[model samples]
Target: MAVKKPTLFAAPLANNGSKWSIGTETNVMKGLSQFHDPLINWSVESYSIDSLGESIALVVRNPSEDMAVTPRVDIYLVSADNSVKPKLLTGSFNAISDSPVFIKDGKKSVAREWDCSPESIVWSANGQTIFAVATDQGNNIIFAINATTGNCTRMTDAGSAMGLGTLGENQLLFQYTEQNKCVDIHILDIETKEMRRLTDVNSDKLRNVYIGQAEYFWFKGALGDQVHGWIIKPLQFNTEKKYPLALVVHGGPQASIQNIFTSTMWNSNIFANTGFVTVQINFHGSTGYGKNFTDSIKHQWGRYPYEDLMIELDHVLDNCSYVDKARMGWSRWVRVTAALVCHAGIFSTPGAWYGTNELWLPEHDFGGTPYDPKARSNHEEFNPERFANEFATPTLFIHGGSDYRVGVEQSLAPFTLLRRKNIPTKFVYFPDEDHHISSDVDQIKWLTEVLLWISEHTNTTLPYNLNQ
Candidate 1:
């Protein structure tokens, strides 16, 4: 007998396949609203189907009833035979906090978070057990969630597991990335709970090159909250030599720095190779720790998270003998802290700054909703414009004109003000791009501008034509 493929049911705007045969503007807008993740990869909220075609599971994100700016993801199951309507599977209280399906270089990055989720749901050969990725207390792991009951069982202990899929009858195949290491494939046996490494791609290429060393540390943060973080030492670092510290802050006020392969945009390997000891602080309001930790910076925003960063910085500079306190510099992409750094004068020796799609407008800050009265007040404090009179750091602002999430004006306004104040500032705008620079050409341009600016300010010379 031939197997029937599962039919998909989603609002017209769902990133992938939708149940609807047609589309409309209103449906698109409704679907767009469900993209709750800061790095919104337009994809289906969730997809799952039983082997016997008895049920289809869907994870949909809808506007939260309590919070106007937040969207909550919930799972629902419907009878495949069409004999029954959809019934909610998971409760509203527990959110499937996996980072969405991450596709990098045409290969799936096996990590899941809200909205953009798992590449595919893993089902046992008998379809009795369903496995999915979830973020539990600041760690990403695979969990055995009941297919029908919507219950969950933790499966893997490896802090991070990506691209999880079924192997053989009782095993799983996934791409694994550990702290300060390269990405590799691994296999897990469900019955005996045994895990075996599959491949080591890093060893072949890195035989002669030194890779950074990484370790985890915790500290007391905002409101005496326990904050977890990671510190990555420069390649071939010496204990007696002090190196410039690079403070890299992650976006998502809701996301945390994971102990996965450090390749992506904030390339830790490149930074380590460039002779900089990198530090990533989960700070306040970072995910994978706990709901309270992630939510700690909800309204606190700039103040608490910055404090957490400062405390971490202080600890590193004090305890770590290799961290050069006089040469400390910081960098962040997308949303968190660019404005805060400018307005608050946080970093002692701020270096060449690279920020894209900066959020500086009161109307657009903090979800752009009237739900929170403090959003405007918070924006007013950290607003890049507020620091124009005293903007001292040499800054490079880049933005995409088509960015709907954060308007180009956010970068343009500050760049103009800084230029007027006679501060060293540069603005690079791409009219065709959105919030993210998707095209390779645009990305290279952005990186080139960043490297040239940093090199100019740091008094280093890179063998690139700066005229480009």
Candidate 2:
């Protein structure tokens, strides 16, 4: 098997009627001959053999680092007997990345990343169709690929559909979630293209809760590309009245704030319920857009994403009459504090010094290590400390002492700077917690502190009594 890159080969399939056996070194066994194009630089992600062992189904991917080149993922079919070369069975599309769908208090939400690698692939009993679950737009939906024609059909609509399993020949069992709904077991009939719910366990608990309505919109962002975002209106919303804006910027930089439900601390509904119009932007570096858009943030993180957020924020303020631009406030992850400082003079983690346990992340984003002369300029250009002189917005610093990924000192530095400058700022420290506030008590305190800080800055009264 003469191939440039390391190749993965499946065990020899049982010979049904062909002369080829386990030891045969035929076209199928020869790595380059399988694709008949050695320069393709493809690797198999997953494979399945038919019951008869005559055909093998494979999921192949070609990844590249160049931002101009889009990554390719496709399904291929090849004969086990070495009788034919590999044939493409589907168009280019990401299978699924390590994107996680969170389930909390019966509600579900998704956190998407730039990597769109598939989770699992399975062939139908008859070997006529293949089923795959992938992240599309903001939802993880199911796709059915035709075995022979390379045609693809979407099986599920609206929400994060996952945990795919073969129930029978033409039926599939899976889990489903939505923006206002929780996780539920579902059954899908592939032959008839019909779906039915198997469980509604969270309906009773969520029946009386007031959940805000989410509206999605797109606008021209940096590079003239369309950027996606969401606006969640307060419950019992009045169009005639102006409301404060709670703009939430997601972490990952590579991750996206999806359209699914979340009942936990980071839920968008929390802001809406507090009489604020909540907004979220899936900026340039967010996942599910495509490889090029995701990689576009490399070496230009602070420039493009910040431009997208400000541009989209302007778009919202211009179009949404109900939003109060004067009372606008935002919260974001610790790593991307440059945006916060640049936009509002508000800053978060990693003050004057940048230190993180994840070396690969910084190296990959900045194009090289901090010590590398060619990449040092990129780091200094985006660091939040460079803009410290302009810091004026009343800021709140929160950190967990056990957070090794981004040490607590990152938050302390900025807090100290603001105090020395006599800026209105507060620090909330959790000595026992880690990167995330996991305990129920800490969760409540975290939310309270955040809401209180935002309410104070925006000069808005809390919908619920904080003293209670």
Give the whole-model CA lDDT for all candidates, comma-separated.
0.59, 0.70
Clashes of each: 14, 1
Shift in Å, residue 232, candidate 1: 1.7
What value of lDDT does candidate 2 attain over all alpha carbons?
A: 0.70
Measured on C-alpha atoms, candidate 1 has an lDDT of 0.59
Alpha-carbon error at 282 in model 1, in Å? 0.4
Query: Using TM-score as the measure, which candidate wins?
Result: 2
The count of residue-pair clashes in candidate 1 stands at 14
lDDT of 1 by residue, 1-468 (tens): 433322254223334564535343221112233343444333346555554545555565543332222344666565544456556655654444323221212323232333223324566666666677766544577887555566666777756788888888989998877665677888989888788888987797878776666677888877898888777787667999877666777765567777676544465555566666778878777776655666566546667887888788778878898876655554632122222122112121011011222322222335443234554455345444444466566677777777665555566666677688887878788889876677878876776676566545554334436575
Every model's Cα RMSD, please? 10.4, 10.8
Model 2 stretches astray by more than 4 angstroms: 1-116, 147-150, 333-354
lDDT of 1 at 343: 14
TM-score of the candidate numbered 1? 0.69
Candidate 2 has a TM-score of 0.72
